[model samples]
Target: MPDKPRLERQAMCDRLAMEFQNDWIVNLGVGMPTLCSNYIDDSKEIIFHSENGVIGYGPLSQEGHEDQHLVNAGGQNVTQMPGWPLFTMQIHSL
Candidate 1:
């Protein structure tokens, strides 16, 4: 996929991110929608709400710091920002 132009991906992700940034409690579906959480700028302070017993789930884990047990439904591990919250998804936006 490295051969593919990154600008297209950036543009697509950016478009969706902008649409959701102003939304409160966005109920994002899975797949590409899940990837959109990574595009929001830090200044925007967008909180990524995830299932798998987490609420404030941040970006995907950096290289070599992955926790296999702490993964989303997609089986990819995620990183948690400082002061982020965790909760049972069944109790929240299910």
Candidate 2:
């Protein structure tokens, strides 16, 4: 049996980030997807959307410097860009 090489978490995130173009609004999921924000290039203007209703956010916040009121869908604290907004998520009865 042959062992397959795999990309590490950060490497995978970096690869994923390269696939996105500038000015695209991207929705980041929990876990690895959330890490992609840290890899996006500075020259690109990609909007990150979180299921928690955070829109236009920046990268994940460094530990101990997290904003108490800002979090991604994964419940991890994240950094906010200019004009970022938090909205309420509503569920309607089917």
Candidate 3:
């Protein structure tokens, strides 16, 4: 079978990132959704949220720099923004 061409993951992320507005708060799920954080426009101040209690985090971590304790819902390592808070699931009720 012939190999089908496909958009690279980064390209896909870039496309989706364009849809977000500056004041929006986005919650990303596992897999492809996690990649969206990497392509967010720098001029915009969109907040990235993770199901695993991470808010205002940056993109995925670089190779050799993974933080075992800082993972997204997908279990992929993520970078936390300065002053980003980690809350328990119970906090959502308040």
Overall lDDT per candidate, in order of appearance: 0.64, 0.88, 0.86
Per-residue lDDT of model 1, residues 26-63, tens digit only: 53445666666667676666666655455566667877
Question: TM-score for every candidate vs. truth?
Answer: 0.64, 0.81, 0.79
Which regions of candidate 2 deviate over 4 angstroms? 1-4, 86-94
Tell me how far the alpha carbon of residue 17 in candidate 2 is from the true structure, in angstroms, after superposition. 0.7
Considering only N, C-alpha and C atoms within 3 Å, which residue pairs clash in candidate 3?
A: none
- Highest TM-score among the candidates is held by which one? 2
lDDT of 3 by residue, 1-94 (tens): 9998999988888899999998899999988989998886778888988897778888899999988988887888888876788765544554
Task: Please give the RMSD of candidate 3 to the true structure.
Answer: 4.6
- Clash counts per candidate, in order, are 0, 0, 0
Preferred candidate (lDDT higher): 2 or 3:
2
Candidate 2: minimum summed lDDT over ten consecutive residues — where? 81-90
Residue 69 CA displacement from its true place in model 3, Å? 0.9
In model 3, how large is the Cα lDDT of residue 33?
A: 88
Q: Which is better, 1 or 2, measured by lDDT?
A: 2
